[model samples]
Target chain A: MAKIRPVGDRVVVKPAAKEEVTKSGIVIPDTAKEKPQEGTVVAVGSGRLLDNGERAALEVREGDRVLFAKYSGTEFKLDGEEYLVLKESDILAVLS
Target chain B: MAKIRPVGDRVVVKPAAKEEVTKSGIVIPDTAKEKPQEGTVVAVGSGRLLDNGERAALEVREGDRVLFAKYSGTEFKLDGEEYLVLKESDILAVLS
Candidate 1:
């Protein structure tokens, strides 16, 4: 598999699979489902450069489960697998 | 007039009025006009906080003519005047 190194505070995520059924036992059609907001961190870029010329450290590391904002990030496919690239700030929280 | 202080690397811009006529002598109606992408900087927030607890300095200052990304920023009205608030990063270039 090809390795992807995101640029500048960007992160690559492997999105969690979308749920097909609702909590009320209703089956939702594929087109009606919302994009998944949760994912596992696959790769992260070095933190954004500060004015003082130092690179800030990112809080999330590889393999961390994270929640990101809905409708954020760019989607792409690599080696038949899908991934998303977005800024670290767009990641709202890391799941325990 | 009420003063607006943008927060955290956000800038307030007074957008240039939309042009009604094209250089080719064609007139465009209000409904056909694109949002203005040029503006003057009116207010700027203190720079974003770096990891080291220092604030980065913004490149655009008050009164600078600038071009920003279209469809970016939040629009609001104060005292009947319109303004836009967006991150400094959204500002593409400072006009000479």
Candidate 2:
């Protein structure tokens, strides 16, 4: 239960760890791995301003797991905890 | 010259290398490093479908270097080269 309040249309995400090992039982190195597809939404901010300048309501609430594309966020760490701040639009799907 | 054509509203970006040596004169390890900022626009797809169902024209053309948030894309490597496909909306700003 990390308290990370994202700013603007940002949402703080804790990326899930890679759990699958290769057929040879080789754990993938961090450098060779891709961006995590799934994340737990720790906190969500008020949605981004629409082109008309009105702040839209956010679609996903906090604690909802979501699917987002890689390369959609500005990566950062808070107190040694890795997280991503992405625009709500970047989130493709919400995991039930 | 690598050829990478993104699909949908996706744009393929070849991330810029981290080149700055720290004050410690040490190159940061990849595992400890963050996502790349600058990128060369290798290819761009037709814009995403708008709410109206029409394809929006992309704001960025191919070959336009741009800045994007780290968590904004789905990362992939093509033929050993790293690239990211992101929705145009995920791009934070265009770098001149």
Candidate 3:
């Protein structure tokens, strides 16, 4: 698999698949599922360049499970696997 | 007029009106005109908070004519005047 190194505070995440089961055990179709906003950080960029020429450290690290904003990030496929590249700010929280 | 103080690297801008004239002097109607991407800064936030707890100085200041990304920012009206509030990153360049 090719390694992806995001640039400038961007992160590459592999989103978790949306759950297809309902509370009553009904299987929802793919079209009815919402896009997953949760993902695991696969890679992180160095940091965002600050106005003072310093790089702001990223709060999330690789292997961290994170929740990002809905409809954020660019999606792409690498080696038949899907990934998303988004800025650190797009990530709302790091799941414990 | 009520004063608006934007918060957290956000800026309030009064957008320039879109041009209605073509090169050949044809007038475009309001419905056909694209949204203007240029504006004058009316207010600015202190700055974006950095990971180190320092605020990053914004490049655009109040009264600066700037170009910003289209479809960015929230639109609001104050005292019947229209304005846009957008983050500094949404501003593309400062007009000289």
lDDT of 2 by residue, B14-71 (tens): 7767552232243434674454366777777656644444467789877786767666
Measured as a fraction from 0 to 1, the native contacts recovered by model 3 come to 0.00
Supply the DockQ value of model 3. Answer: 0.02
Q: Per-residue lDDT of B29-77 in model 1, one digit per residue for the tens?
A: 2332232266788999988888777887666789876656567999999
Q: What DockQ was computed for model 2? A: 0.05
lDDT of each: 0.68, 0.62, 0.68
Best by DockQ: 2
Q: Taking chain A by itself, what TM-score does each prediction score?
A: 0.79, 0.69, 0.77
TM-scores of the candidates are 0.45, 0.42, 0.44
Report how far residue B51 has shifted in candidate 3, in Å.
1.3
Instruction: Give the lDDT ranking, best first.
Output: 1, 3, 2
Rank ordering of all candidates by TM-score, starting from the highest: 1, 3, 2
Kindly list the per-residue Cα lDDT of model 2 for residues A5-90, writing each as its tens digit: 77777787776555521221222225633453666678888766566656655666787765566677888877888888887767
lDDT of 1 by residue, A1-96 (tens): 125555457777887765622322333345644533777898876667676746698889999877787578655544456666678998987877
- By TM-score, how accurate is candidate 3? 0.44
What are the runs in model 1 whose C-alpha is more than 4 Å off?
Answer: A1-96, B19-36
What fraction of the true interface contacts does model 2 reproduce?
0.05
DockQ score of each predicted structure, in the order shown? 0.03, 0.05, 0.02
